[model samples]
Target: MWLTGLLAAAALVLTAPRWLPARVVALRAKVFAKVNGDNAITFPNAQVGPERFQEVYGHPAANGRSRGAALSDLFWYWLSPGAEVHQEHLEAGPRYDDVARTTRALLSGPADELADAAARCAGRVLDELVTGRVTPVRLRDLMVPVWAEYCYELVFGEPCPRAARDLIAGHADDVVTALKCTGLRHPARRERLTRYLARRVAAGDVRRPLPASLSPAERVHYLQGTFFNTAVVQLSEAMAHLLLALAQHPEVADRLRRDPADDRYFAHVLDETLRLYPLFGIAHRITTGEIDLGGGTTFPEGTVLCFSYPDYHAAGHRDPGVFDPDRWARVPARAAHHIPFGVAANRPCPAWRLSPLALRAATAEVLRRFTLHSTVTHTRSLPNRGPCLLVRADGPPPRHLAALGAFLRVRDRWEDVWRSVVQLVLGTVMVLHARRLRLAGRYFETHDTAGCPPGHRPPDHRERAE
Candidate 1:
């Protein structure tokens, strides 16, 4: 009976989001709203439970006071994961007297350099894949290292040394790690990188001005952090997605190849690919005071807010699930809301400007060189799971074969839809079972002590008033 109830409850929670009435969802959304503010909403983390927060930040003290004074610090630390260490390093550094000038100095470079590097790297990787020169070659593996090398060259004015690659690759476990060092897990590697960067600074090869406030150690950390956080990490994933997108939509690929100089077409395709498979699926922000997000939904101060790219696109756009680059042309306003790099207001990626340029160059080169055949496989991970495509260079299929391939792609999309529905159903059933058991247990605890079996009740509770 207990097992049966548990199963039923599990199914309900899993399916609740899908089946819950629109009004209920809206009301729930309102509950997250700030008092007296319009349109701003908050995620109290109530529905999903507090486990995630506790897991990331550790549990609050027993008396409910945090170890830190500033809530924003905790919030930022939570959102960016490993950024606090880098932020600390940046803060400890000598403040650059002219931040704007320093920023300009950091960003200054001939755009063509990045483009040339991207084209070269893309050509080499695609050639290897086409010729079967490398076995078990994954697109991301090739792209990450190649892009890393290019970025190192662009930033440091020389090729990336083998040691730097080893250190960066070793530490780069995920997107956050790419941005900042989370801990002292790789102390030896960190030390080596510090020494290497310090030497580079001394040589005066790096054109980017170091803030006078930064100590030598902080300067090293800042350079390493900035280099890693820039184009390489995000662009690699975006480039992978673009390849898969082109392979699946050969019509678009053909169009791109035919008119390689059409910047609008390239931008549309990149934008659409990002929309379909964003590098980071969601962006998190904490409310500062009350915010009116319009529609009578206001979020209170300290509320943890999430902007899910997928959810926003799905709710706002027509046929949001489909990969149609043409839609961007029709709905220019929709494209404005696309935030693949990060939100502009809060934690924007420093590489946002260069990333698109590099992607455009790399993608154009790839399409020009080879006709791609690709299959996208999705992992079972929730939320963050984006499209991962397995691609092979098939040269170019014959016209008849290409038509047949397009048909199959459409059919495959339908199959994916059905698969998602079936999975949702199964997940919903499990959540329902879990919910049922929870309610049953609550009832049993509250009013049915007389019916409790021996050894089931707590020792103190087992002793009746008599």
Candidate 2:
């Protein structure tokens, strides 16, 4: 009887790789909500489906950023040192406008101009490697230096040295790793970046205007939060997703390579990649005043609204799971449910126009040099950092990538079992720690704060916006 009981326990443990991950994920989300307190409401508010995604997202009353200051704590903790000044977290008003203006100015180049710069920077970053050999590459890792140089030039009109590239890449990687719950926040690594940006800002190395409303310190943090940190992190992540998509779908890659000049095809590919794997996840806002959505539906003041980009993008489409760029031929990108960039009325991505153009250029450069291939299961939350193989484009048909892909797939599944567990532990701890730290709360208390009092919303965190 004892032997049989032990054997059963072992069997359960052995097969955990299959079932444990999903359970752990669901539990983690529950813990996350509990720790954070579910005073907020989620969007695509089931009653409406995807029909009112934009309506709620773009609503003027749903425009408050700092109102839900407790949720901001988790974000600020994860993206610390200068996270308080990250443009996305700032409340709407003159300060946001100034930061937005600076961003627009920096990203103001023509589409062709941005593309050329991106291609030039990308081509420069790709060092010569052994051809005809399968090389495992982390797409985010590869794209970081490319974007580091490109973004560096955007801030300062000179070439980025290898040293600067390393610093920028390290800072960006640390932030992304923490954001993905793969690692803990390392304030020392982030502080080093803060110091560097401080010096640059003091020296007026910032060629563009920062928020004039900020003090000297706030100016430094603004540069780090906006330019060096968020811009580099996002652009690199988007490039990784794009390259991974090309790797998984060789037909699309082959077509792109054959017609390297086809910007339209490239654009479609980018739109689809983002639609499938959006960079931003849930972007939540708190209402400053009551919002009436006609039909007698109203979201009361301080109602926390969560706009989930992944859910919104996945719904109301034909075979939303399938990766089909041809779908774009029938409908313009703007017309689709895709909001890769946020809603224009409520703080859209400042680089909306430039991001697609830069990604297209960087991808074109990559395809010109090498053929990408991957068999790893592509996921929206690519915490695996996009496993892929790079083959020289000019080389003969490469050998079996199946072995590598198979290994990655298995490794990823097991990793998910452990990673999910880690996320639960870390996410809960950080949520609690953030609540204690009250980074955003402190910032708001000192500066001008927004409307919502934490935990004052509906009956439960599970309550929805009707």
Candidate 3:
């Protein structure tokens, strides 16, 4: 009879959500409607374009390169798993140091005993192209002309008397042709590259091919390369989101500017920002096992469902209406539940640690050098969040800038002191909680009682008749 009652109770618990108060459903529907409407208003004609894939130069170039390096480092760390590779090499090194060094000497060096001058020249040309600083006309310019010189240097262990330059002055087209035909597809990407490579290849250019000694498979492997382009794109989107948020909430930017180096504070601001304006508002998963998520929602095997991150964040958070980090500050460590990236059990961003760390580092550095003050007005009368800050980079001292300098410095210092105070307070509370827990454990062990131990009552106990 007891088991029957328990089973019935469980059934009610499962079905309770479907029978939830109408208010809850209406609230969720309203929020979803607003979100969709905002998306349409902001990006009605959103679609990927050809120029999106092409590289940018100058400041954009510098920014992209920085993001690319971070991405490369993160990828290598992910691939190696246990290898404690430094981020710098993961960003720039061709491969593991030993292998990269050997390849450089053979395919990229001036060493007469390595490979040949052509290979070396080709390496230089490709290096420039990959960096997006220069463009080349042909493949031999990179492979034949450069490889021959490198090979001669490797075989004889001495500088070739022949000038490696003229070996392919007019043969640049051949090298470009090989690069275009190599491998990898993305119609837009291919189209842009073909214009550069095909024009030269059509001019009857000739240069050394990757040494006939290399097996076809090996040659293909040599051509297959890794790039940080994906990382660059992701980082750019993240930056755009962050900038937009900051523009909307100038006060948060001001707070962060006060103590830019405090990783904890920076993290809190980012968390709140993400909660309010998540980059990925939803994530989906195919269930593999039976699990009960309270209210009649028993997810069975192979069931596909999408988890609304923004909605979950709103529901689990203390005060969903406000963009306040103080709410996060108040959540008990064990009960904390904000999933800007995704849920803790299954994060959408597998590279969470690295990506956030890179972002924090870059933001901290930028804040250190400049005080970003903006006067840009946000788009009002819409649910969409965006920032329009007129950014001004200010620093150091001048006679007229004295007052502004003092204000900025004071603002930064106050944030530092405030964070230290909060940490001290939290530390005290944690120590008190630990002491209480230990004492309670000892009392229970001695008294041999289960549940709430007899008469050393819980705090806020009610008086009873004697």
Query: Against the true structure, what is every candidate's RMSD?
Result: 16.7, 6.7, 27.5
lDDT of 1: 0.50
Give stretches of model 3 more than 4 Å off: 1-187, 190-230, 289-296, 332-334, 368-387, 395-466
lDDT of 1 by residue, 270-304 (tens): 88887777765434443435554356644455444
- Which is the winner by TM-score between candidate 1 and candidate 3? 1
For each candidate, give its TM-score against the true structure: 0.59, 0.92, 0.36
lDDT of every model, 2 decimals: 0.50, 0.80, 0.35
Q: Which ten residues in a row are the worst by lDDT in model 3?
A: 52-61
lDDT of 3 by residue, 137-186 (tens): 21112223333333334323455334432322222222222212221123
Error of 1 at 237 (Å): 1.4
lDDT of 2 at 319: 88
Worst window of 10 by summed lDDT in candidate 2 = 456-465
Model 1, TM vs. native = 0.59
Model 3 scores what on Cα lDDT?
0.35
The digit string of per-residue lDDT tens for model 2 on 1-466 reads 9999999999988888789977977887776666446567777875656888898899888888864536777888887776656788777765666667777888897778888899899998876322446678888888888988899989887788888887888888888888888787788887887788788888888777676656688778877778778899899999998889889899999999899888888888888888989988788888888988878778888877878888889887788889998888987877789999888889888888888888888888888888887877677878778888888777785556677778777887777788888877887777778889988777766555522234322122123113
